[model samples]
Target: MMMTERGMVAPVAGGSVLAQFDDVLAAAAPELVGHVQAVKFDADTGRLGVVPDASAYGTKLRWCARKLVTAANAKVQGANVRTLHVLAPAAGKAGPATAAAALDRQPAAPAGPVRTRETVSDGYCRALAAHREAMPPRLADPAIVQAVERQNRALRELSRQAFPKPDAVEDTPARLQRRRQAAATEAAALRRARAEKAGRQVAASQRLEQTA
Candidate 1:
């Protein structure tokens, strides 16, 4: 990984993360132009491939890749900055580290999931579904993730929490294989919707062309 560029500072400091595609490819060739163009990760199918053809998007791709490299490095630097200002605990010297250790030595109380008990917010239920292992087999299943996410966004606004980002975990080889199989199941429904939309647009355009 590249070090932080000159004059860049991170907001939160250090965290492990990845950009969607470019970083995976351009790691080998830092001088490579354009983004890791046309990348796909097929979990079930166990596929990780990229087109790497950034002729049209060359400038934008390189700009984004450089930005991603800079951001990751800045995070590491931020943590080092915080440690420099740690003040020693006073003349009698009751140190914060000693107090922290005392707190850690106490027996930790057991924690459990918050009980909604029939008063579940729509957002929480939807989050559970979106993160489900095997989604329900019903017509309601298809729109549940969307409904939950939309509701979750509204709830986040009300509660002052940030909305969740898109999935960041890269699938393991096994999970990728399962997701590939699952993806196959959804592909037909996806195709049907696209064909229906395309047909409607084509019909409307043909009518205009005929009248012209």
Candidate 2:
């Protein structure tokens, strides 16, 4: 097989050609694999055929064939991929049967976000749910009131401790005034710079006229 700086130009063949090509393709453009439904490489002819999942992706593969070839050649020992051929699968048959079959198979529902009992938030929620059960309706009114007040006090303390009062934020009016002042200062500086530049240019022109 012929090789160049750009990449392999000759035909490639071997027992592990398919596996090697997939690995190279994945390494070169990981996103391209998802767009491609299947791959068929003719080592004898130096042609690489790709069955794209969609028409747009088929066009995309053609556009980026050069970079793809170069990358694959760099990874594979004797990869000779001269041309990239985008194959259009026949009706109801797109690429490999395995891929279509896999798509038809329903995947198990993915596990959701896990909440551990050990977390403070989880414990707090659990405590709230069980609080009424702990204090049955038969409990004395005074005892219930005392329990509620104690809970409120604890929550208030926790709120204070968990989130300490931030330094007083500058009110909107003051913030706006500061921004306006800064903008005015910047505008003045810009105007001064422009004036200085104009003065320098005028001085240079005058010097040139005198020299003439």
Candidate 3:
């Protein structure tokens, strides 16, 4: 017999039962200690009511119910916690059900104009164009370069879907040649700038060595 917090005789630990069970659970499963809100043990039927902080934790507790029962019975003498009942989280706590109810209470979203393939294609094309414009000409970091390449590939795929082969017009030979020449000119300018910067660095290092 155990004495209750109210000075009444009980078959098992009454108010103190909660603290004892908390310790047992913490020792048995440390991860679940923080999730458990409260513990109630019914000595008559040997049913243990475990109130969790959330519904997710309740599910988790249920998964390891057998292990908990075994651990509890072994740790607490005469505990005989046979059945584990995972009670709902305390009132006022927002759970999945509560969130769903709140969503149901909200007004339905206003209807908009129906979109067609042309509209979607136009949107994708605009987005791809904007992203391409925003992308740097060259990325120094390998990681940044890889990331930019991935984005470019995704955008290009979207653009291809937007402008299928049958509908797209090919660029003229003259225009293609001009684009190639422009790209070559840009590459040459970049190389020249890099070379100049390297030469300056080397000259500065030589000057430092002479002074030393």
How accurate locally, in lDDT, is each candidate? Answer: 0.45, 0.66, 0.71
Clashing pairs in 3: none
Best of the candidates, lDDT: 3
Ranking by TM-score: 3, 2, 1
Query: How well is each residue in 1-212 modelled by candidate 2, as lDDT tens digits?
Result: 23533345433343244446567568766777756653556666666665666667667777888877776667766766667666653333344564444343424444895666655686778899899779857756898899999999999999888887767444598889999999999999999999999999999999999999
The runs of at least 3 residues in candidate 3 whose Cα sits more than 4 Å from the true structure, single-residue gaps closed, are 1-10, 14-16, 91-212
lDDT of 1: 0.45
Candidate 3 local lDDT, 1-212, one digit each (tens): 33443445434443445557667778677787756744456766777766776777778889988988888777766566788877756445534454344434435654896676556676888999999999989749998889999999999999988878964767899979999999999999999999999999999999999999
For candidate 1, write residues 1-212 as lDDT tens digits: 12333324321232212222334335434454243332222222322222323343344444454453443335333323211111112222223344334334434654876566777888988898887857755566658889999999998787654544458546699998998989997998899999999999999999999999
TM-score of each: 0.16, 0.35, 0.37
> Which pairs in model 2 have colliding backbones?
none
Q: Give the TM-score of candidate 3.
A: 0.37
Worst 10 residues of 1 by lDDT: 81-90
- The total of clashing pairs for model 3 equals 0
Candidate 2 lDDT: 0.66
